[model samples]
Target: MIFEDMDRIVFAGDSVTDMGSAQPVGEGLFENLGTGYVRIIDNLLAACYPERKIRVTNSGISGNTSRDLLARFQRDVVDLKPDWVSICIGINDVWRQFDSPAIPDEQVMPEEYEQNVEQMILQVKGKVKGIFLLSPYYMEPNREDAMRSRMDEYVAVCARLAQKHGCIFVDFQQMYEDYCKIRHSTFIAWDRVHPNRVGATLMARAFLEKCEFDYNHGNGEVH
Candidate 1:
């Protein structure tokens, strides 16, 4: 696995990452990690690499855009001092532009979104061992859809920054697009944004793949 023993990984994003995680910080026992992909990643890490003793933290906040995430980056991410950081934001940035067209201030344009994410990466890239840039996705499979098209723009920005900064780019938008081909977007999320358990698992699988997680390691062994 890419993560070293006792590596502390912090996941920062919006509601998709939050998914009801404990306030301020989410970690430790009793499901404080929430029921999202973050918790799934933690569970799999423990089950597959019992000796690694990886520490996982969820710093996601609901309804947060890249702007909001940047505002709290220092307190939620930097001060926490994580070894690995996974950022999944920008959904609300695109959503707000379409959902509330009248409110210009509420909308975070593509240029600002790109800058906000880049600034966050610049702030933490040197401090953390590595960073994972998970693109903000709109679940609609139709590329022609206005929201999905706009979301693709943000996804491109994430890819560009990930490459420039040497961060791992997890193309979540493409992941959902592939899944939506077999199953309708509504099947995973009615709004095609906040995923249910199944969609969350898909995300977890994708993340673990990038980490080179070995599923067969402890498959037949009983702890």
Candidate 2:
């Protein structure tokens, strides 16, 4: 309910947000929104708030780090002139460090990651109605796990930036932490990064909770 009628929201980040969405920008009809939380949110908005007529756009790209997002922020998000924007990046920033240790350039260090995200927030802070700063997560439940621990640092960065910029913070890492306790992360994502439908649904629910969506609204009435 935070969004008003005809509000345009753009979801920007990496493959986690991308899934299989159309390149450059994805919106309107068919699978252009991809098969991720963005699509589910689009569906829920239409189903629960038929009168709002909110528009959701996907600006995520596969294999992108915060650096990549910052590079395209102006073109993919700012130029689109969205009323709201959600950014969920940084996973590849840490993943590259572990997966390809030899490539220093591919790995975006924490300081740079923070800077990139902050630049992005600054780009649209006053222009957009609001911003969603979603934390990058690793599905591993163990706090001591190397990747999970490193991911927590990035989550902390997101939290800090959200507070500094007065943006709405959606802690996807914490959301996954609680859900992973109930069911193994493997049940949600085999690779613990790219989530299947079940994981995507959980993500969509988490996002909607922050937006004050009414799950039971219009249940007995037809659209």
Return the TM-score for each candidate structure: 0.97, 0.97
TM-score of 2: 0.97
Give the top-scoring candidate (lDDT): 2
Which candidate gets the maximum TM-score versus the true structure? 2
lDDT of 1 by residue, 1-223 (tens): 8988899999999999999999878999987999999999999998888878899999999999999999999999999999999999999999999989999898999999999999999989888899999999999888999999999999999999999999999999999999988999888888999999999999999999999899876674744
Worst lDDT run of 10 residues, candidate 1, spans 214-223
Off by over 4 Å in 1: 218-223
How do the residues 1-223 of candidate 2 rate in per-residue lDDT, one tens digit apiece? Answer: 7999999999999998999999999999999999999999999999888877899999999999999999999999999999999999999999999999999999999999999999999999899899999889999989999999999999999999999999889999999999988999999898999999998998899888888788787784755
In Å, residue 150's CA in model 2 sits off its true spot by: 0.5
Candidate 1 achieves a global lDDT of 0.93
Model 2, global lDDT? 0.94
